[model samples]
Target chain A: MNLVIVLLIIGLLMIVAGCWCLMRTFHLLKMTIGIEVAMKAVTLFLVLAGRISGKIALSETFVITVMVAEVIVAVVGTGTAVGLFRKYGSMDVRNLKQLKG
Target chain B: MTILSICAHGFIYGPILVVLIYNLFNHEFARKHFFWFAGTGAVWQILAAIGGFTALNQNGQTSYAFGAFWDIRLAGAAFFELNATRFLLLLIVGLVALISVLVAHQTVDFNRSSYTNLLMILVLGMNGMLLVTDLFSLYVFLEVTGLCCFIMIAMFRSRADLEGSFKYLILSELSGIFILTAIAFLMMKTGSLRYADLAGLGQRISAGSGQLEDLLVYAALILLISGFAIKTGVVPFHSWLPDAYQSADTAVSILLSGAVNKVAGVYGLMIVMQLFGDVAPVGPSLAAVGIISIIIGALLAVRQPQYKRVVAYSSVSQMGYILLALSTGTTLGLVAALAHILSHTAFKSTLFTNAAALQEQTGTLELKDLGGLENQMPVTAFTSIIAFLSTAGIPPTAGFWSKILIILALWQAGSPVLAGVALVAGILSSAYLIRLQRTVFFGQTRPELAKVREVRGSVLTAEVLLTVITLGLGLLYPYILLLLHAGGIL
Candidate 1:
């Protein structure tokens, strides 16, 4: 049951989720969720890849490390969102164009 | 110590050594020690480069990692590749590391300890980026660098700076997805994660891959290149750069443009270039990107009202030169690219520091707001003029010689059109840079700005140091090139 199809679906969904977060959502929190969903897809693909290739331990280590890194990135993303909300009075990216040419 | 000892011990451990040293003392106690790390990192980089150069002279390329870190079954490990590309890359990293401490001291005055700590991580990330070889570690180091960049940009948590950092975060995350997907495809196809292994796989593909496999490989290559290009801000992928550079603190801008982009983008491309031997599509596509970035960056820079944004757009143009040089896929082109790497690092860092000085003194980076500080701060005026000239590829500055070399290399490589376009774009950059000079330094001092005085202390020190190097390198490139050739670095 766990095969390349499963891996392919996860990766595709993650890419779609990332695209949705970036292209559709104007809100920072949702964008962060989109990033998390997307990276989870990458993590699953890596582990399944290791399973298929018979290098489960190595892939597991990579997954664990990636999880930690993803968390940090998410935390930073959320923190920045909070900062943006406080300073700009909105979480919308369109409103944050004070530094244009 | 011998090169082997440092490569085996220090190169891998140097950043850790820096981190441990930072953690051993309180932030106040550890603030200036960051300077020591940067200084020592430069010395160690030079030693490692000498070692790498000598080794490459004897052998071709060397890869080293602790055997303990390796799973005997799996080939990839925590590793570093020392070849011509890395030799120059490390030296550039060393230069950025040394300058970053100076930038930190100037811009970060409050809660200095926290600044030092974050900067320590930043330096660690760059050092890792220069040294890491495998694809997985490259992504990790890149993210580490990215995280540090986000924090540094929004360190003050100003409304504008935070937004810039968030934009950067989003783009970087997007690039990350692209890279990881590409990497997964690569590993699934190649069954190995190491560059050496990739080379073997590339040979197999070149010998004759199925149409589907070939398409997959090309798709993966596109994804990987797009990831690096986004980081590099090469033309169509450059929206994040102006925002990031403009909204960040000036010192942060110096470090970001001077060092971070080179490590993350240029070095990333070089590593991937290793995998792309004799691929027919690589060169022409790369050249097209170079030209696009050059023209767009030059034209956009001409209209930028803010000084920081002008320099930022100009960086997009300069990076185009490097990519174009690399796209030639010839040894001379690579050499020219390396020279441009050094030249850009020196001049761009200096120019950004001067921007900092301008901001500190005049309190405005908007060109239309004020002008004519040449009479008040002669050093800033003079050093910045030299930097501007260097950036515009004016003669007697290092940029001039390197740009000429790139054009010459392109011509020799049978691309007269590109060479001519590069020349014209070089002139276009000068037009904007001159406009910049006329507006910022050469104009009449505004009534309110008449009392501006010369900047003193560490900021001036950073500007003067980079200024002298940019000027000195311009006059001294021929000898330097000869030396590099002799050293087997070119």
Candidate 2:
């Protein structure tokens, strides 16, 4: 029980850090790193929660899927960032405001 | 494996296979054979429609079963089940998917075979999303669809397109994370991630167990709503919508406005919430967002110079009607929502195709630059009129019928204010749409537009076919009502 609580706290900390990276960071690469961290947190929670409920396999599958999704999202996001860099030569979020309402 | 289930699998995977086989060849070969994918999709829709129609005639099956398909247990925990309305929803999506790809072929400049490949992936994702019964697998499919759409948007590799794709990617990623977190909470609380498990719990609660006082479930529910609302482009959560629509290719716009957002946002929410009850727990808040989208989209669309952006905002507004119907929490309301979805998908897609044709000929999509095109491009003019009138809920159009039902549902459900506001928005829509119609197609022909000729091939066919179908449904409104009633929607 104590181990589960400790794991949950670590997961929560990672979640906060991941969100901070996404919400506050301006660099696209850093933003991706933030998402990756959050994904790791989700992975931890899934496995620990599974262990708590005696469904480790189910949680592990979830972890695997999340990792796969994270990879795809990261790869695609990097490709997009490269394209943006080619077009505008910047990785800043504020620079992507051309479509004014 | 039963023969029938194998055949059912063909309906989902057959078009995907066809598209993949074509892509294995050179780009020129794939470009020439884009319609083959459409052909496969049409065949699938016809078969599904026939099956659904037969089921309707038989009053449909009452049992909801999953855990296996053709004696195949998915190693993954994902499962499949049918709602009373599944076949109908599938049939509608199949039609939209077919037309959307056909329109996309006409609109996009083919740079590679992968363009068609991405579209096939999108259709597969949407099919899985609508059909999959497990919440986790459903989210997987949703992300697949979202990823495909993101990639497709950036296919043109233009600065505007890239920016639009990037914004859309970030927002969609955020929504995805929210959905994942929500599902995790639900899974933890319930010890199962299947829809059946959640539905069973909800059933017990409704059957005199107790009022749902669980904070985790409530938190999960709110997160799910927020995630899908951002996806659906409802007001306040709709910042990326117009940018993506205006910047993406015309065919992509049709796919996005007509099908993807509807499926990912509205239908996604509906399916998840169905486990709880007919009227979802978040109905009131969703309805509030829907109303805000309607008025704000209408007001903003009227002032836009770009025709695509105009249509894009109008899409946000039209979706409001569907969402309002959904929030009413009655079978009649569901029927209204489905009906509106069909009409909107039909006319809105046709309108976007017409917009594409205009841009193709005029080299401009700005409203101010277009005038008196009817004399030159009569098919586009005539069909666009039908399309916009249908959008504005004018009589004898399917939009008219669906809007009436939605308004009636609201009033009968004791929200006369919303009914009145929706009725007034109908007039507001006509005002702007008529303004656009007159500016673009009526009055004196601009000197440049006078030489423009109507597109004489597949583009015209797609537009006319969708417009004709919308008009036909309106003309045969009674038959649709009878069919829905037969299908147990009423």
- Runs off by more than 4 Å, candidate 2: A1-13, B1-7, B52-77, B82-84, B200-213, B278-281, B482-490
Which residue pairs collide, candidate 2?
none
In order, candidate lDDTs are 0.79, 0.78
- Per-model TM-score, in order, reads 0.91, 0.91
Worst 10 residues of 2 chain B by lDDT: B204-213
Model 1 agreement with the true structure over B1-490: per-residue lDDT tens digits: 4455455355556666666776788666666555565556556655766675676567544554433244434545556545566667776766666676676666666645555556667766876777665778888889998899999898777777897899999998888888887776676566556666777455556525454445657777888889999999889999999999999888778778988898898878777775784666767878888899999999999999999899999999999999999888777888888889899999989878888888888888898975888899899889888988888888899999899889988998899999999998888898889988889888678899988998887789888889888889898988977886796645
Candidate 1, residue B477: how far the Cα is off, in Å: 1.8
Error of 2 at B340 (Å): 0.8
For residues B1-490, write the lDDT of model 2, one tens digit per residue. 4333443465466657767677677767667777775557655765765564465446545533344334436454565554546656666667777776666666666743666677677777877787787788888889998999889888898888888998898888878877887777677667677775777555333323343324546667777888998888888888899999988888778888888998888888686556654424667876887898899989988898888888888988988888888887777888788889888988888888898899888889888899989889989988998888899998889889889889978886789999999999988788779888989989999987778998866788788889889999899887877886697655
Q: Report the Cα lDDT for residue A56, model 1.
A: 76
- DockQ score for candidate 1: 0.67
